[model samples]
Target: MKSKSNKSICKICGSDFARSGMTRHIKSCLGKHFKAKTKGKAKRLYYLHIYAFYNPDYFLHILISENARLEDLDNFLRDIWVECCGHMSSFMRPGQHQEIGMKNKINEIFEPGLTFSYMYDFGDTTELSIKNIEIFNGAIKSKKKIQLISRNSPPLVACDECNKNMAEIICAQCQWDGTGWLCKKCAKNHECGDEMFLPVVNSPRTGVCGYTGD
Candidate 1:
């Protein structure tokens, strides 16, 4: 199915919601679907929202453990969004030393209303803005350190050449020039040639350094 450009899918209820309504809708859906509470430790769950810094088209709402390491979030982001060539990544808050954030647990750095930035692939960097939405005193019943609560379904992109069909590939060299999107039909005639074409994936890293998909 074609995804909603400005909406996301709620994992709990399988419903689509606009960006502004998703947070509240997810909380309500979770309440109805998951009555079971954490059984073992008194853990805290950190609600987080991650989005493209420049183009808010791609985004995700996640619940991460307070005890989870910064590296865990980094790895999760890599697995789902930005890991193409195994490049170095780090989370940073303005004016803070990078080492401190890299070495700390997520809870150590997170606070109410805290906002931060993440960088993946130092060369052709895919930067993301991360905000701590809220903190829950109890944890969800999950073994994973990071749980994907909701995510923006892939935004619909039409071929730039024809503006009719969905884009199937992006020409990296042409993307910077602002006219590279192509469908399978138009890809046959792309001036940049097939060698420069990258598969159009549901990621901000599309058309970037060696990144086809997660």
Candidate 2:
């Protein structure tokens, strides 16, 4: 797991800075500014805020080009939080059962005040609720279709048995009975045994099937 520090390294300049300040710093960085000027084309971008539907606290803020396909967004989500076992996934408009496909353009389907749903893995689905927060017309530093703006730090879950050390595993079977979390030590001694415990990861899909997160 990555450190929860506010600091991040600037990819353009190889300089260290607080996460909140990096955006501003990058705009003025010599390397990035030069690249933007060289490209000479600014694209329309959309800012999206997405969170796990059932676990709202696990969230991400991202920027994607308006021309980018829905498939790009779907790929980004899978790479960052949910892909495991190559399960099928889909996007659906609110209150509708019809599934939206990858060929759709972002600008065609999303706008401010619009919300969408994403379901990964048909059987043990990990659902996400996405909202179009804002739209921007500007130059992007990265060529990637999706850029991560920010994300909620991985939450700390205490060991259910000791109530001290951070939880390292979750017993899927015990989750329903409300005593699933356990640290490394407690997990070995858990009544359900280690086989029932899944490694806790920084993802909403944690403890679901064979998912261990990327």
Candidate 3:
């Protein structure tokens, strides 16, 4: 998965950036190119950069208000990226065993350079890497507890069968070896049969459990 190239669109500018460069891109854009009405009352919000753990291509850029709780972030993630079957999920320090409570206030735990791990659906295990990148004001004039500022563009994979065309389906049984991407046409002729197939969705949870897409 690391070898795959990935990119995301910056909603503010409508320009695309490579995964490796998104952090720098957003940091600069948020201040120079885009401005938020952070006036009114004094407010601080945490800018979190989140992405799939080992599979970094799938990612999200969020601006969470200081008053927001961990639960707010968890719900936002589930709504957009990984909530399949309502399985339990948690956030923890990257190398730790303890889980952070959903009720914990963002202002209490968030700090620049802090990176954490998020696991969704323990059984299928779609893990994500979350990091508090920066603290900013106003939150783009949003009232919501958390805002999804940006997300990675849908990754395109070539069909393993014909070696051309974007893959739209995966053979779940064959995904373990990372060799089951299939285009619409090739998916019909997969030797594993149609029952083992799963649609290739945008989220990192694609092909896992009963996930189809959001």
Task: Specify the highest-lDDT model's number.
Answer: 3
Top TM-score model: 3
Ranking by lDDT: 3, 1, 2
**Candidate 2 C-alpha lDDT tens digits along 1-214:** 2123334454445676654565456445533443456445767778777889997657776778899999999889998999989999999998887899889999999988788999999899999999886676665566788777566566777787788888889998887676887789988888887678788887889889888785
Give the poorly placed runs of model 3, Cα more than 4 Å off.
1-6, 33-37
Q: Native-vs-model 3 lDDT?
A: 0.83
- Which residue window of length 10 is worst by lDDT in model 2? 1-10
Worst 10 residues of 1 by lDDT: 30-39
- Candidate 2 regions exceeding 4 Å error are 1-39
Q: How many residue pairs clash in each candidate at the backbone level?
A: 0, 0, 1
The sequence of per-residue lDDT tens digits that candidate 3 reaches over residues 65-153 is 89989898889888898877889999897689799999999998889998989999888899999999988776445568876778988
The candidate with the higher TM-score, 2 or 3, is 3
Clashing pairs in 2: none
Model 3: colliding residue pairs: 38-138
Task: TM-score each candidate.
Answer: 0.89, 0.81, 0.92
lDDT for each candidate structure:
0.80, 0.77, 0.83
